[model samples]
Structures are given as structure tokens and as C-alpha cells.
Target: MLSVRAYVPADEARWDAVVAQSRNGTFLHRRAYMDYHSHRYVDASLMVEDDGEPVAVLPANREGDSVASHAGLTYGGLVASRGLRAEATLEAFERIGEHYRGEGIRRFVYKPVPHVFHAAAAEEDLYALHRLGASLVRRDLSSVLSPRERPAMNTMRRRAIARARAAGVAMRVGTDMAPFHALLASVLERHGAVPTHSTAELTLLRSHFPGQIVLHEAHRGDELLAGVVVYDFGHTVHTQYLAASAAGRACGALSLLLAELVGGVYAQRPHFSFGISTEDEGRVLNPGLVAQKESFGARAVVHDRYEWVL
Candidate 1:
């Protein structure tokens, strides 16, 4: 029999272990990452067991009458061990439904781990959601590059990188996040927005997963021109945040940094994600932003949202 229960503080180690061993889980799903901004949500994460052995975990949180896959994450979903199969996944979902219904939650929001992030094919929960009559509510388009079969970098991107190199733009993998965060804040300020995480939060996160969370920067004659923070998931590396200064844009510092990442540093990785180019729950696509990503030989992959009334 399959069973589900609310995750407690005592379950931290076990929860992290399951994520480390799961086919679809990344370091992002670990409690260490999830709890960094705990004050923002009421965690409703679940642990699933089969005959008393932990089999799966769902990273989620409660919001009024509904429960959603944790909002702080890029993608949250069922992270299952290698041994889990389709039938058991369905049972797990059924048990999850029962547990939440008992808690007075009237709706469930889900976002399955994107296929590129999976260490193996782990879409049993998607099938389970379909069986449960879930509605496909949103789809955000992200650009991803497959290193092994990627297209050549477009001419415009190449020229930009060349310009940066000619301007003596240097790429550094470093620990000082403040400079980059400052540049990021300035870029977002023009759009009347802000970064999702503060420098302190990022520093804390880096402390938790030192090797997985990395900062790469572009500099020219002591000036911090551009930077990107990447979350490395072994098989894949995702650009969690990227920003460029005005000088950086003029000299193509951002392009240079990305080129080094996709072609020099992380070229051996299976995938490199440039993140989403859509907004307003996926209704709007930022054409210029996506075009820039595509210039680096990246193509479309989707992050989806699904909902079902309980």
C-alpha cells in the first residue's frame, strides 16, 4: 500500500537523500534550498512511501484553499526513486489528493520537472496528472542548448563575442556576488523589477551548495561589465540570473560570458538552459530576449503548469 504524509522538520535528511537519489530531482529540490525563504510560504511538501519504504517526494506549499508546487523554485514536482513505476505513481498521487483534501485544500497546482532536467525518463507523475483530469494551465518557453548536437552560434552573437574579446573583456568564475548583484539590480531597475533573491540569500544558498551554485562574471579593466549565476545540476547547468551593464552591452560582455559558458566551460554538459523568455503566466513572449538566447544555438523547451480541482 502507498501512503503519504506532511513533511516535518525531522524528515530533512531523508527528504534530501531521496532528492539526491531520485531520477528527476536536482539540488534545487533539497530542503536546504527550499527552506531558505521559508517565511514566504506555508510548506505543504509531501513524502510518499510504499509499504513503509520512502519512494517519492513532492516539493510543494499551501496558499489559502490551494496547494502549489513550491513557488520559490524554477520547477517543482514529484521526485521519485529509480524503482518507481507508472502504477505506483498513480497511487501516490491518489494518496496526495486524499491527504490535501483532508486538509481543506480545494485545488492542486503542479509543475512537472522539465525533461531536460531529468537524469532519466521520469514522467510517471505527468501520466498520473492526466488520469486525474488536470488542466494544462500555462507553458513558459525556455531556451536550451544541447551541447552534443548544437547548431553553430549565429553571426551576430559571434561578432558580439569578438567585440568583447577585442575590448579585453575577461571572464572569471569567482565568489564575490555583490558586484554582480549590483549590476543585476541596476538592469532590473530600468524595467521596474528586482532580482528574486537578495545577495545575502544567494550567499547563504552558495554556502549550502557550494559546488553547484556558481557565479561567472565578465570584466574589462577592473570594471564589472556582466555576470551570470548558474545552478549546476551535473548533467545540466541553468542560468538562474543574468545581467549586463550599459558598458557591458556596448562591448558585448554578456555575449562573451555566455559564449565561454556554452562553448568553453560547460560544453561537455548535456544541457545548458538560458531560462524563460515569457511573462504574464506565459502569455507574452519577449522577442528580443528569446532571439538573443537562440543566437547561441539554444532552442525551445517548455516549463508547464497544471491544475486540478479537488
Candidate 2:
């Protein structure tokens, strides 16, 4: 028998345990990450059990009349154990629909983890979503590099790195977010935009996930010229934020820093991600941004969302 229950504070250990075992889970799906934004969303996350043993966890929240698989986070879905069978998964989703329907919830918005993050073979949820008649709602194009393939860096990137080296720019890895955040804020402000995370918020996340969150900066001696905030998610090292100062751009400091990350820092990783180059549910693509990422041997990977009536 399968049962779905609402998540409680006491479920923290069990919840994290399931996430740790799930083939598709990342640090972003854990309670430590999701609850950091507890003030903003009405949490409705669920834990599914089979015969009193935990089988999966759904990190989600209630927004108005619909339940979203975590609106605050980048992606969320059913974090099912590696051993969980497909039929069982599909059935558990049916139970989930009933559970929410009983609560008067009419809709479900799901964001599945992309295959690139899977520890083993995953994607039973994709099949279940299809079975449930889930509709595609949003998609964002991310630039990803398969380092295992040892993709060739474009000539333009090689020239840029040569310039950065000649300019004496160096890459440094540290826990410090202060300088990088300032550079990020400055760059974003010029575009009349803002970073999704504040300095304090990012610092808090880093504190909670010290091993997973890292800051890499391109510096010329004491001056910080360019930087990228990387999230280490097992198979993938994701560039969550990247920015460069005018001087950094002119001297190609970012180019050098990225080359360092790709060739040395995260060389062993199967994939490297340059976060989405689209806005408004992928309706708008930023040509300049896409071109810049593509120049580094990165190609498109879609982050998608689905919806279903409960």
C-alpha cells in the first residue's frame, strides 16, 4: 500500500535521506536549500511512503490555488529512490493527485530534474507526467559543455585567454562572496536588472552548503576583475552567476577564468553549465548572451516545467 503525507519539521532527516538516495536529486532539492526561502512560500512538500517505509519526497509549495514543485528553486520533481519501480512511481503520482484534490488543490506545477544531474538512470517521473497528461508550460535554454568529450574551444575564446594571460590575470577560489557580489551587482545594475540572490542570502546558502557552493574570481593582483559563482552538483558544475567589470572584459579576464574552470578546476566533471540564456518562459532568447556561451563550446539544454489538473 502507498500513502502520501504532508511534510513536517520532524521529517527533515527522512526527507534528506530519500533525497540523498534519489538518482535525480541535487543539493537544491534538500530541506536546507528549500527552507531557506521559507518566509516567501507556503510549503506543501510531501513524503510518500510504501508500507511505512519512505519511498520519495516532493519538495513543493502552495501558490494560490495550485501546488508548485518549489517556485523558489530552479527545479524540483519526485525525488524517487533508485530502486523504486516505474509502475509504483506512476501509481504514487495518482495518489498525490488524490491527496491534493482532497485538500482542494486543483492544479500541480512540476519542474523535473534534467537528465544531466541524474546519478544513475532516472526519469520515471517524465513518463508518469506524460501518463498524467501534464502539459509543458515553460522551458529555458541553458548552455552546457560536456568536458568528457573534450570539446574544442573556439578560436575567439583562445585569443581572449591569451590576452588575459598577457594581462597577468589569475583565477582564485575562495569562500568570500563580498567582492564577487559587488561586481555582480554593478554589472546587473547597468542592465537595469538585479541578482536573484542578495549578498546575505547567498552567504547564508554558502554557509549551509559550503562544499557545494564556491566563488571563483579572476583577479589582477589586488583588483577583482571578473567572477563566477559555481554550484557543484555531482556530475555538473553549474555557473549560477557570472559577471565581469569593464576592465575585466577589455583584458579578457573572464575568458581566462572560464578556461581555468573548464580545463583545471572542474575538469573531471562530465558537464559544465552556463545558466539559462532566455527569459519569459523561453519566449525571448538573448542573442549576445547565447553567442558568448556558445563561443566556449557550450550547447543548449532545456530546463522545463509541466502542469496538470489535480
Candidate 3:
């Protein structure tokens, strides 16, 4: 028989061991980061045990009547071991609903895992969510470039990349966080959205990940035009955040920045991820933005989100 309970402090080492062994694991799935970030919200981490051995873990945050899987996490869902099959995953989720309901949580929002990670789970999880009246909100698509293979981009985008390179825009990558944060703030202001992280969070990530947190900057002489902050996870490089100045748009700086990043990844990691974009049928869903990334030979892979209300 299996039992579910709140995460205990002593479970840290064992919990991390499980995450490290799982192919679907990500930094956000680790207990340390989750514990650090969950302080800002409610911590609702659940650990499943089979005869006292930890089998699954799901970290979440509770706010009023709603609960979310790891509030600041980019991707989230249940993390289970082989012993905890599909039926067990569903049973764990059902227990989660009960706990949340008792805690006055009426709605639950779970971040979706990419197909790559989702393939390991028991198929019953999908059915359980639907049977429990969960609703699907949005689906995103991730694009990747494999260093072993040519980038996957359309001809027009390829030409744009060539044109940008021919223009002689210079690209540089570093670990400096100050300039990157400044550029990021400026870009956010242009879009009328406030930054989600403070300088401290950026610093924390840089300190924790070291070479994994890379900053790519595009410049012309003394002027900084665009920059991107990426996370290098050994096998793949993830574009965590990016921003561009007005001068960047005029001088093809964004294109140059991407070219450098892609080249850098090609020289090292097996693949690079361009994150995802919002879906919009009318105008290509940030067409200019998508085009710039697509030019670097990225191909879209659909990502979906799942939710449940208890």
C-alpha cells in the first residue's frame, strides 16, 4: 500500500536522489529550488511512499482557494518512480485534490510537461485529470536545434539569418548579470510587462548554475543592442530570457545574438531549445519574434498544460 504526506525536511537527500535518477527531471523539479521559491507562496509538496520508501513527489503552492504546481516553475507535474505506475500517479493526484480541498483550495493549476518527459508517466494520469473535470487552458510549442543535424528553418528565415550575419553585427557571451538585467528591464518596459525576477534572483541562478547561466550580448562599437540569458543543461541549452533595445531592431542585433548563441551551443551541447510562443492564428503569434528564432533553424514541438479543480 502507498501513502501520501507533506514533504519532510529529512527527505531532501532521498528526494534529490529520485529526481537525479529520473529522465524527466529538471532544475525546477528539485526540492531546493522549489523550497526557495515556494516561500513566497504556500508550500504544498506531496511525497508518496510505498512501505516507507519514497516513490513520487509533487511540489505545489497554495494561494487562497487555488493551488498551483510550483508557482514560479517553467514546467511542472508529478514526478514518480517506476514503482509508482500510472494508477499510482492518479492516486497521488487524487490525494492531492483531497488535501487541497480540505485546505480550502477549490482550483488547481498544474504546469504541463513536454511530450519528452510525459512519455514516462502512466497513461492513466491523462484519464484521471479528464475524469476529475480538469480543463486545458493553453498549448505551447517548443523549437529545438540539434548540433548533430542542420537547423530546421524555412528558406526565408534562413536568408534573414544570412543577411544579419553579412551586416557585420558583433555578438559576445559572458557571465555578467548587470548589463543583461538592464537590457532585460528595457525590453520588458517596451512590452509593458514588469520583470518577474529581481536582480537577486538572477544573481542566485548565476551563482547556483555557474557556466550554465550564460549571457549573450549583441553590440555595435560602444552601443549594446540585444541580449539573451540561456541555461546550459549539459545536453541542451534553454533560452530562459531575452531582451532587445530599439537599436537592436534597427541593426539586426537580435539575429546576430541568436547566431552566436546557436554556434556556441553547436560547439558544445547536443541540442538547443528556443522555449515557446503564444498561439495566435491571425498574426503568427508574435510573428517578428517567432521569425527571428525560427531563422536559427528551430522546429516546433507542441507543449500542453493540464489543470484540475477539486
Candidate 4:
């Protein structure tokens, strides 16, 4: 029999240990990351144990009579070690469904990690979600580049990088998040919005996952021209935020930064994600944004979201 226990602060050590061994789990799923924003969500996270051994964990929170696989993070679902077989996944999800139903939770939103980010096989939960009749509710396309098979940068982008390098625009790992967040906010504000994570939140996360989350910026002496905040997920590194100033665009500083990142610093990683270029629950495509990412030789991979009536 499988049983679930509500997660609490004391469970951090145990929970993180499981996540560390989870095939599909990224640093985002760690207790340190989830608990950092605990005040924002009604924590209903769970630890699933079968025959007295932890089999899986869910970084979830309550929403009405429904439970979400963590709305606070980009992706979330059952996190389990590669040791679990498909049959075990199905049984485990059945237990999870039953537990939620018993607690009057009406539905569950499952966001499985995309295959591109996986360091090992981790799609068993997808099969179980199908068995539970989960419906696909959203799918965002992320642009990605594989360093070893990297396509030649188009002539324009190549020239931009060459020109910037020729003029001495430099890209380097950075410690400051304030200026970059302001740059990010300014960029998004032009389109009528703000950064998803405030500067404070970003600083807090960096403190928790120091090595996992890093900042890279393009500069000319004291001026901050462009920057990107990257999340390192072992085999793949994702660009969480990308922004450039008008000055940056004129001098092609951002193009230089990304070129160095995708071809230099992160060149050996299996994938370099350019993040999503979709909005409106993934129903609308931003052609211009997609083209910008594609200009760097990136291709698309679907990051899907699913829903179920518990």
C-alpha cells in the first residue's frame, strides 16, 4: 500500500535527497527552491511511501478542492529515482489520485519535465498521467541548441558577433543581479509587463542554489549593455531571463553574449535552452521572438502541461 505524508520544514533533508536522485528532477524541484517561496503558496506537498520506503515526492500545494503540481515553479510532477519501473509509476499515481480524492481535492495539474532536460529516462509519469486520463492543457515551445551539432550562425548574427568582438564588447560571469533585473524589467515594460521574478527573489534563489543559478552579462567597461541569467541543470543550461539595452542592440552586445555563452562557456552542455517564446497559455506564438532565437541556430522542443480531475 502507498501512503502520503504532508511535507513540512523538517522533511527538507529527506525530500532533497530524493530529488537529488530523481531522474526527472531539476534544481527547481528541490526543497530549498520550493520552500523559498513557501509563503506564497498553500503548501500541500507530499512524500509518498510504499511499504515504508519513499517512492516518490510531489512538490504540490492546495488550490480550492484541487491540488496543483506546484504553480510556483516552471515544471513539476512526480519526482522519483530511475529505479522505479513503469508499473510502479502507475501504481504510485493511483495511490496519489486516491489520496487526493480522499482529501476532497477535485483535480491535479501535472507538469512533467521535458525530455530535453533529462539526464536519464524519466517519462514513466507521463504514461501514468495518460492512464489517469489527464488532458493536455498547455504546451510551450522552447528553443534549444546542441553544441556538438550547432548550426552555423547566419551571416547577420555572425557579423554582429564579429563586429562586437572587434569593438571590444566583453561577456563575463557576473555577481550583480540588480542592474540586470532592471534591464530585464525595462525590456519587459516596453511590452507592458515586468520581470517574472523580482530582483530580490532572484537574489534569494541564487543564495539557495548558488552554483545552479548564475548570471552572465555583456559589458563595455562600467556600462551594462546586456545580460542573461542561466539555470544550470547538469546536462542542460537554460536561459531564464534575457535582456538588452538600446545601446546593446546598436552595438550587437547581446548577440556577442549569447554567442560566447552557447559556443564558449556552455558549449559542452548537452543543450542550451533559450526558454519559451509563447504566451496566452501557449496558444499564441510570437513569431518575432521565435525568429530571434532561431537566428542563433536553435530548434524547438515542446514543454507540456497536463490536467486531471482527481
Candidate 5:
């Protein structure tokens, strides 16, 4: 028999274990990462079981009559154990809907794990969502590069990297985040926006998962020129945040920083994601933002959102 239940403190070990063995799970799904901003959301996460053995976990939160797979993380959905088959996954989704309905939730907002983050083929949830008549409400496109079959970086970008090198830009992995966060804030200010995570929150998260979350900085002598906050998810390394100063942009400091990461640091990783370029729930595309990423030989990988009415 299969069943679903709300997650609790005692379920932490089981939840972490399920994520650790899940084909599409990243460290972001772990409780430690998900609960960092627990105060901001009413936690309604779920765990599904087959004969009392944990099979899947949904990192989610409840707001009003809707339960979102996650509002805190980039992407999430039914994170299934490696051995879970299509049939079992469908059943898991059924139980999840039933459980939420019992709690008076009228809708489910699901943001599925993008394919680029998968360790192996894991599209069971996508199939399950379709069967349940979930509508694709949103689609954000991310740029991804695969080491095994990467295309050549555009000549303009190549020249930019050369320019950065000639400017004596230096790249290094750093533990301090304050300097980088400051630069990131300044860059985002130009667009009338701010970072998703507060500096203090990012600092705490880095402390919680030091090796997995890293800050790559580019400097010119004593000046911080550019930086990219990276989230290392085993086979994939994602740029969670990125920014550059005016001088950095002129000198292509960010370009050189990416070259160092793509060519030297994480060359063996299966995927390197440049996050998203869409805004307003995917209705708007930032052409310039995406073009810059594509110049580095990255291609489209979509992050999708679905809505299911119970």
C-alpha cells in the first residue's frame, strides 16, 4: 500500500536520505536548506511511502488555498528514489494530491526539477503531472553547457575573455561573501531589483553547506571587479547569483571568471547552468541577458511550472 503524510522533525533523516538517493534531487531539497527560511512560509512538505518505506518527498509550503512545491528554492517537485518506476511515481502524485485536498488545499503549484539537474533520467513526475491534467503555467529558460559536447564559445566572448586576462583580472574562490554581495546588490540596483537572498541568509547557508555553495570572485589588484555565487550539485554546478562592476564589464572580468569555472574548475561536471533570463513568470525574456550566456556556448534548458486544481 502507498501513503502520504506531512513532514515533521522526526522525518528529517528519512527525508534527507530520500533526497540523497533521488535521481532528480539536489542539495537544495535537503531539509537543512529548505527550512532556512521556514519563518517565511507555512511548511506543508510531504513524504510518500510504499509499504511504509519512503519513496518520494515534496519540498513545499502552503499559502491560502494553494500549496506550492516550493517558494524558497529554484525548482522542486516529486523527488523520487532512484529505483522508483513510472507506475509508482504516478501513484505517489495521486497520494500527494489526496493528502493536500484533505488539508483543504484547492490547488497545487509545482515547479519541477529541470532536466539539467538530474543525475539520471527522471521524468516520471512530468508524466504524472500530465496525467493529472496539470497546466503548464510558466516556463523559464536557463542556459546550460555540457562538458562532453559543448559548442565553441562565440568569438566576441572569446575576445572578451582575452581582454580580461590582459587587464590582469584575477579569479579565485573566496569564503567571504560580504564584498561580493555588495557588488551584486549594486548591479541589481541598476535594474530596479535586488537579490533573492539577503546577504546574511546567504552567509548562513554557506556555513551550512560550505563545500556545495561557493563564491567565485574576480579582482583587479585590490578591487573586487566581479563575482558569481555557485551552487555545486555534484554532477552540476549552477550560477546562483552573478554581478559585475562597470569597470569589470568593460574589462570582461565576468567573462574571464566564467572561463575559469567552465574550463578549469568544473570542467568535469556534467552541466553548468547560467540560471534564468525570463521575468514576470516567463512572459518576458531578457534578450541581452540570455545572449550573454549563449555566447559562452550554453543552450536552452527550461524550468517549468504547473498548476493542478484539486
Candidate 6:
């Protein structure tokens, strides 16, 4: 028999065990990440079990009438063990649907696990997602470079990096909160946005995932130019959050920071995820941002966001 339940504190060990066994799993699937993010977002994690064995897990966050599976998570979806058939996946989704309805959520957003992370899945299990009333939404393209192919800088990229380097820009990596937070805030203001993570959240993530979370800062002597927070998830490196100051822009600091990150930290990982861009072969939203990533030789590997109205 199968059962679906809310995540409990006691399920930590088993939960992590399941995540560890799945290629699609990420740190967001870990208890600590869910707990920390959940505390801020409130009651967002869900799990499914069959005969007392965990079959699937969905990390989600609730805001008003909407319940998003792993809202803050860049890549997310159901975490199932190998050999889970379509019937089982569909059943799990049904249970999840019921749970969302009971919880008064009007919409359920599901983030699909990337293909690279689901090498062992059966076709039927993969198709079950669409079979469950999940419609496609957005997609993100990822770029990767093997260790040997990693180069310092290409033509166009080199020009941008050179401009910054020639201007005497320096890069720093650390976990300090004050300067990092301030620099990020400045970037957000320039972009007419707000910082997503609070100071406390940044501290928690850094403290928990020490080597995994990196704060890269570009500076011209004492002046902070640009900074980005990269997340190193075992096999993939993600440019999670990034920002640049006005002065930094004058010297092309943002480009330099990315060049260093790709050649430096990400060179070690098998795949480096530059995150998503709205630009496709046809014009789409956020074309400029997409073009910027492409100039770095990033290839689009399309993935979808699924949604169901409860």
C-alpha cells in the first residue's frame, strides 16, 4: 500500500537516504536546506511513501494561495528511486494534488528534474508528469565545460575580461556578510530590484554548505565592482545570485567575474550551469541576458516548469 504524508522531523535520516540515492537530488532535497528555507517560506515540503518506503519527495514553499514545489530552487521535481513506473508516479501526483487541495492551495507549480540527473528513469515514469495535468511553463539552459576544454578566455569574452583586468580589477572569494551584502544591495538597487535572501539566510547557507557556496567579488582596489554567489552542488556549479555596482560596470567587472568563475571554480565540476535565459532562436523575454550567456559559448539545454491548478 502507498501513503503520502507531510515531512516530519523524524524522517530526516530516511529523507536524506532517498536523496543520496537519486541523481536528480540536490542540497535543496536535504533536510537542512528545506528546514531553513521552509522556516522563512512556511510549510512547503511534501513526501510520498509506499509500504513505509519513501517513493517520492517534493520540496515546496507556500505563499498565499499558491504552493510551489521548490520555489527558490533552480532545478527541482519529484525524487523517486530507480524503476518507479508511470502508474506509481501518477499515483504520487494524485496524492500530492489532494494534499494541495486540502491545504487550500489554488495552484501547484512543479519544477522538473533535469535530464542529465535522471539517467536511470523509465520513459513511462518521465511521461507520467505530463499525464498528471502538468503543463509546461519556463525553461533554463545550462552550459558546461570539461576540465581539458577549460580555457582562460575566448575572443569576445577575453575582450570583456581584459577591459576589467586592465582597469586593475581584483576578485575576492569569501563568506563575510557585511561587504558582500552591501555590494549585492547596491546591484539590486541599480537593477530596480531587492535582494532575495536575507542576511541571516546567506549566513545559514554559507555556514551549512561551506565549500559549496562561494561569494565572488570583483573590486578595483577598495571599491566593490561586482559580486556573485555560486552554488557548488556535487557535480554541477550554479551561478545562483549575482550583482554589480555602477563603478564595476564602467570597467566590465561583471564579465570578468564570470570569466574567472567559469575557468576557476566551475572548471573542477563536470558541468557548469550558467542558469537560464529567456532568449531562444526566436526572440523571447529577457533576450539581452540570454545573449550575454551565449557569448560565453553556453548551449541551451531546455527544461520545463510544470503546473497544475488544484
Q: Between prediction 1 and prediction 3, which has the larger lDDT?
A: 1
Write down the lDDT that model 4 would get.
Answer: 0.88
Q: 197-260, model 6: which lDDT tens digit per residue?
A: 8778888978987887888888888887888888777676777777777777778899998888
Q: What is the clash count for each candidate, in the order shown?
A: 0, 0, 0, 0, 0, 0
Model 6 — which ten-residue stretch has the worst lDDT? Answer: 116-125
Clash-forming residue pairs, model 3: none
Stretch of 10 with least lDDT, candidate 2: 170-179
lDDT of 3 at 226: 81
lDDT of model 3, residue 310? 81
Which regions in candidate 4 have their CA more than 4 angstroms from the true location?
none
Candidate 3 residues lying further than 4 Å off, grouped into runs, are 116-124, 145-147, 152-170, 219-223, 267-271, 279-284
Q: Which residue ranges in model 6 land beyond 4 Å of their true spot? A: 39-44, 62-66, 83-87, 98-107, 116-126, 138-154, 279-284
TM of each candidate vs. truth: 0.98, 0.98, 0.83, 0.97, 0.98, 0.83
Query: What lDDT tens digits, residue by residue, belong to model 4 across residues 93-180?
Result: 8888888888899989888888988878989999999988999999998898897676678888998898788878998888979999
lDDT for 186 (candidate 6):
71
User: Candidate 3 on 1-310: residue-level lDDT in tens?
Assistant: 6777887778888888777665466666777666655558767777777888887777777778887776678776777675666677677777778877887888888775564443244345566687778898767667777755756556765564566677676877655677778878877887787677777787786776676677777777767778878776666678888787776776667766776667654446666788776545222366666666676777776665666768
lDDT of model 6, residue 152: 39
Local distance difference test, candidate 5? 0.92
lDDT of each: 0.93, 0.91, 0.70, 0.88, 0.92, 0.73
Give the candidate number with the greatest lDDT: 1
lDDT of 6: 0.73
RMSD of each: 0.8, 0.9, 3.4, 1.1, 1.0, 3.6
- Pull out the clashing pairs in model 2: none
Give the C-alpha lDDT of model 3.
0.70
